[model samples]
Target: MRTAILVDGGFYRRRAQSRLGEKTAEERADELNKYCRRHLYHHGKQVANLYRIFYYDCLPMDKKVYHPLLQRQIDFSQSDLRTWMYAFIEQLKKKRKFAIRLGKLADEQAQFLLREDITRKLCRSALQVTDLKEQDFLLDVSQKGVDMKIGLDIASLAYKQQVDQIVLISGDSDFVPAAKLARREGIDFILDPLYNPIKPDLFEHIDGLRTCDPHFNPNWSEKESTE
Candidate 1:
């Protein structure tokens, strides 16, 4: 059967870090591709055309941030310069702590302020705050779009019937509707979830589901790194 591999780049990257140890984007893609090929062949479902690997990621302009690492690769610098403005905003959050004086407020308000002080102390001791560079902060802010892009592409590919089977390598529940549609269309939906298992509702929508263990394999590298 013809098979298509639709990748959620951000999802894969984050999950891969936990399973395969920390790795760059290119290394993560290499590991994922290797496992995918071996799994497909093991199931004896190959032998036909393997459709193009569709990677769904937002454009820099759409994200409103130009990641230097990505921009350097494309040789497109000087894009989205205001992305670093997040640093200024973060500083503002740290500096704007409300203060309360016992004599200036009523009894109930003073008690409320005391509780707030305890909570603030707990927060300060528990959570570790750190600054982010322009690229890192932009990635943190623009991560929501990654899931939307993945869901949209899943529905698009199934509606088009570009391939017989779709290998979705994600644990996102957002694709539940698309998975259900693929099932209705008689398309084999194989979910290659990361170490984190897909939710029960999402699995119920798919035809088949699988997971990649910590063990590494070969026979899946189409070219060099796929980033």
Candidate 2:
């Protein structure tokens, strides 16, 4: 049976950092393939056909701003962290089975005003006005259109009959609808929470709740270590 592996890039990175520890771009790129293949065991046999691996992520935020934590002016383009992340993405793109999907990161305050809670606290003297800082007013950057792209790809995979099964590496419940549709289309939907237990409702939509994390289940990994 042909299977496809899909990943939420942000989710994968955060969990991988915690679970697998930090890895260079080359190491991460190699593990990405290994983790995708670990799920092929169905009824005790691996599926030889891996259709492809789809990874969705946003470009690093590029901005010239004052760093609140560092207390200095900084250009995002010149940041070491940003440079490393881009290199990681580039390494991922080099893999033939992997497809990188790009989205955008939006600065919330660019379109929205300061949060009401902060305003209220300051008015009530709960927060000293003198203590107000630029970081306090700065808004968080959020990924935009990543979920929609994932859903669209799920639909395309199902409707086109590109793969009979899909292994998704994500914790977000945003995939519920897409999973339902794929399951209805007779595609086996498997979810890998990467060491985290997903919401109860999420388990109902997927045909399998399997994870490759050795920490989650020691015995399973012990018996099956090659993957």
Candidate 3:
């Protein structure tokens, strides 16, 4: 049976950046893909077609310290949009014999705008950081819509029986409901967390779960050389 692995981009990036703070985006992506492929094969599942990799995230603002192109990628949230739109269209098709309904603004699109608003508000807050005082308000670089996207994809895949197994690489409890549904539908769901304790809610729904050991893998310092 073929396996389809879904990755939460925001979750992956945060864990990876915390570990490999000095590594370039290219390095991080490469390592992440490598790790994912290795783990998938470890479970004796062949990755047929590498089905839909819906990267759920939002865009970073221009003023943000993060890379601009990377920010653009976040803003575009292309992969997330692709899957979301595809689901919407599929629903429309099933509802009517010849449905041609246009899709509306997505949850991610709204989140992107809201996050930008929050960033501006944080900058204006009176509790500004002094030279000696650390800033209390942390700005979020639009990483919303990920949970929703992940939830939608899991449910859709389970309903359609797209793959024999679904491997999720996220630690968020928000996915518990969708995972539960997948399990009820007899889909094998596996959760792979990035160096975080798996929540009990996840266990209530998924077929199996495991954490990546930073000690064995040493998520950090993959290489001393910089890009």
Provide TM-scores for the models: 0.55, 0.78, 0.59
Off by over 4 Å in 1: 24-26, 43-49, 58-140, 215-227
Runs of candidate 2 exceeding 4 Å displacement: 42-45, 66-73, 108-139, 215-227
lDDT of 1 by residue, 1-227 (tens): 88777766556655666546765434444565565565456556555456655554332222233344344222113343223222322322233221111111121211111234344655777422233222332223334355656666667777888778887877677778877888787788888776565566665788886665533223334364463
lDDT of 3 by residue, 136-173 (tens): 22333334455667787788889998877777888677
Ranking according to TM-score, highest score first: 2, 3, 1
Identify the candidate with maximal TM-score. Answer: 2
**Which structure is stronger by lDDT: 1 or 3?**
3
lDDT per residue for candidate 2 within 63-100, as digits (tens), equals 76555544665566777768778988999988888899
**lDDT (C-alpha) at residue 1 in model 3:** 59
lDDT score at residue 218, model 1, on the 0-100 scale = 34
Predicted model with the maximum lDDT: 2
Q: Candidate 3: where are CA atoms >4 Å away?
A: 43-52, 63-137, 141-144, 212-227
As for candidate 3, its clashing pairs are: 58-74, 59-74, 59-75
TM-score of 3: 0.59
